[model samples]
Target: MRVTEDGRGLQGSVAPTPPLQAVVWATGYGPAFDWIQVPVFDAAGEPRHQRGLTEAPGLAFLGLPWLHTRSSALMGGAGPDARYVVEALLKRT
Candidate 1:
């Protein structure tokens, strides 16, 4: 495989495209939940709630993007998510 730079002289590479069964992109979304009069999903393709605290009993979320910071949904933010879930659970009890 050879990688060629574009006109801008930036390094790039080209690899054979692999077949995909589905293409559910998680590119994130903008703030658009006004019309959604129900549980909403945040930028991480997960349900949006206050620190993963869902209205449903015993239901919560974690690792949602833009929750705590821009990296909340990332792998590094799982700890925070866990905390939120635990807190919510505690509140329920």
Candidate 2:
């Protein structure tokens, strides 16, 4: 897959958005604590997780809200987010 960004959002045109085999809206049923409009996601546009940790065993989130700090969910705070993920993984065993 060819991927490039021009810094103005998407630089070049992309092929038509393909249809999904099965669209599973990952929008979690809202967070237990509401904070914003629309489903709040981490900087990766993925679902938010607590400390990047999931309830499922061996499963974890990488970048998510409140993983380490108030701003960790934003783009520049991935460091703490990553650390949290590692911790969660280690505890899974």
Candidate 3:
């Protein structure tokens, strides 16, 4: 993968490869939450929540690492957390 800065933003490109079965691109980083100008994060910049429900009424997080349980970041774990958050969202409206 090749990344270039185009003044306005960064552009990523991948060189052509022979018939591929799988491709995995790892950014080697974590999610950025600084852009969220809310009091939902803790001192370490991690979102503060309970079972995916944040202190902020309109804000909620899903599939985050250990958002509720050990498997919170796994695909199978997402279903339960997603359902919980969705239920909370529906109740809000």
Name the runs in model 2 displaced over 4 angstroms. 1-49
Candidate 2 C-alpha lDDT tens digits along 1-93? 211232112122444234321111212323332222233355755555556554433444443456568766565676666665666576565
Candidate 3 — worst ten consecutive residues by lDDT sum? Answer: 20-29
Q: Which window of ten consecutive residues has the lowest lDDT sum in model 1?
A: 1-10
Highest lDDT: which candidate? Answer: 3
Residue 31 error, candidate 2, Å: 13
lDDT: the better of candidates 1 and 3: 3
Q: Each candidate: RMSD to true structure?
A: 14.9, 12.3, 10.8
- lDDT, each prediction: 0.48, 0.44, 0.59
The residue pairs found clashing in candidate 2 are: none
